[model samples]
Target: MNNQDIKAKETTKDSKYIQQHLANERTFLAWIRTAISIIGVGFLVTNLHFTMRSTLSPLGNQLATLIGLVSVAVGIVTIILSAAVYVKKIKDINNQTFRPPVISMIFLGVFIIIISLIFGAYFFII
Candidate 1:
């Protein structure tokens, strides 16, 4: 066979959707990074509260603790959901039936808003 013919055969052996798969993987990694950041902030906030406990009122300390715990829970949930999303996307890509996950996007948006409001209230209280 000619060089072009051999290369075409090799290309066919690889997935035609390689680019889409790569993009999906990148998106998964981004989600993981976001989860880690959320977890890190949770830990940081909790530690900061402990560090400054002497100056904090009882209610302020409790609120900080609650916020930190909630942050960690949200991060954990994000990790799980992102993994699920990654799996679903892989299936969708392979089937050539990809569609944006609108519900997940809406849930994430609402979650962020709620978290921001909680943070804002906590800061306002302190």
Candidate 2:
């Protein structure tokens, strides 16, 4: 095969590898939107804390505060890591070495656990 043919094959449009890279980019953008929503939730919760404090029991009030703080913290943390992952993933794709270290997934698991805990606390207390 000619060099042109090899070059074309290396980065073919129909290649699964190319499709996966595109998919990753789309997923990264989706994650960014999710992070923004999370930050918004954090902001709302923290601000709403003042308005709801009078209606909530003592434990409920505290739980709300904890959830607010944790939500913001987790949102910030995930935002940083997600950006890093997205950049690294792009680099990996360019180098044809698209493997993740799995740290982000682990972090995601932890974030889910935190959210679950927050809800569980609210339910148990109320």
Candidate 3:
């Protein structure tokens, strides 16, 4: 084989690496699905505010709308950030670079905490 062909073969990853890359793609897609679900929940909450106007106080409706908007914003941010992170990870993997998972983990944890607090406010304060 020519040097060019040999070099190309050398750079190509094996089946294991390909599997890992596929797994990463699956994970990214899962995050996208989660974001869509969050958006759907947000829309539902906003719609509820209008449908139950007679039963809900003005403040409660406003709170619900705010929560819904925030949820949607968060979901959009998550999708953007997650896609960026996924791309970075894939590049790192291909380059054989070590990447710490701390950042993504912390972001997800904080996101969950914030969502939990919003749920608490919705149930208790609203």
Candidate 4:
């Protein structure tokens, strides 16, 4: 009904903005979880490959083991970078200075799904 009333309404909207920012934080946490899963899978692959090769094919086993290790290392790096970016994004959002250029999450989701499908098929099928 007055200037004070209008200001209160504006603050409420800003609070909603903050809520969305919290949602972003939750989403980033989810990303971290996915990263952990990815890293775990990489380790699992390395171990499983090594165990299967415990009795044969020394050279090929070593190569495959190295590749699995590399996958784990890459997963760690990816997670570290993602965390850094998430913190930067949160800062930008708090300053009200960033609008995402694209739905980065869409790509992320797609990649995760694809990985899941590939791994699932590999394990559950022949």
Among all candidates shown, the one with the greatest TM-score? 1
Model number with the top lDDT: 1
Cα-based RMSD of candidate 3: 3.0
Cα lDDT of model 1 by residue, 1-126, tens digit: 999888877854228789998999999999899999998988887788779856798777888899888888888988998899888988888888999879978988998898898888877877
Error of 3 at 122 (Å): 1.3
Cα deviation at 103, candidate 4, in Å, is: 9.9
TM-score of 3: 0.81
1-126 per-residue lDDT for model 3 (tens digits): 999888876746534378778888998999999999999988997787678656787777777888799889989997998899798878877777847899769978997898888777776754
Q: Could you give the candidate ranking by lDDT, starting with the highest?
A: 1, 3, 2, 4
* TM-score against native, each model: 0.85, 0.68, 0.81, 0.58
- In candidate 2, stretches whose alpha carbon ends up further than 4 angstroms from where it belongs are 1-21, 44-50, 100-103
State the TM-score for model 1. 0.85
Candidate 1 local lDDT, residue 25: 93
Candidate 4: regions farther than 4 A off: 1-16, 54-59, 101-126
* Inter-residue clash pairs, candidate 1: none
| Window of ten residues with lowest summed lDDT in model 1 | 7-16
What are the clashing pairs of model 2? none
